[model samples]
Target: MPHFYFHTENGDCIRDDQGEDLPDVEAAREEAVTVLGEILRYRGAAFWETASFSVIVTDADGRTVVSVTARASDAAPEGWTLQETGE
Candidate 1:
């Protein structure tokens, strides 16, 4: 197994000081997608404030293995809003 680090960039650079041990790069990629989804689900509104969001995964040697990014393609439509009922 190899250790992997997942660093994120939205408005600020967040580094994963403590990495995880994974089987391979493919597993890390899947983890990145799941991590991004959780961030979006909990912080969707704040996330959109930034131009883009990204997850840069690096291996134990600090070499980038995989990357995932999401960007806002267009401006939000008029009257567009997100409401949460604490669900």
Candidate 2:
């Protein structure tokens, strides 16, 4: 098992000082997606008009494994296409 940090970036930095012990990176990815969905829902649909959101998952050694993001505008990052997927 390994500890992973789920840091959030919306308007400011949310440092994940307390991490969780997960079996591997795949588990972390699932957790991150679940967390990100919660955050987005909490913010409500109105918030998306103003800001893009992301959950950055990092390992114990501080290496980013994956970044799950929700785009807020027509101008999405290059190489990334915006798909309207609702859960």
RMSD of each: 7.4, 5.8
Per-prediction TM-score, please? 0.81, 0.77
Candidate 2 lDDT score at position 68: 95
lDDT of 2 at 45: 71
Q: In model 2, what are the clashing residue pairs, if there are any?
A: none
lDDT of each: 0.89, 0.87
**True-vs-predicted CA distance for residue 40, candidate 2, Å:** 0.8
Segments of candidate 1 deviating more than 4 angstroms: 75-87
Model 1 lDDT per residue over 1-87, tens place: 899999999989899999999999899999999888887888788776996788999998999999898777587768989887885
Instruction: Summarize candidate 2's per-residue lDDT along 1-63 as a digit string, tens digits.
Output: 899999998877689999899999999999999988898889857446647778999999999
Q: Any idea what lDDT model 2 has?
A: 0.87
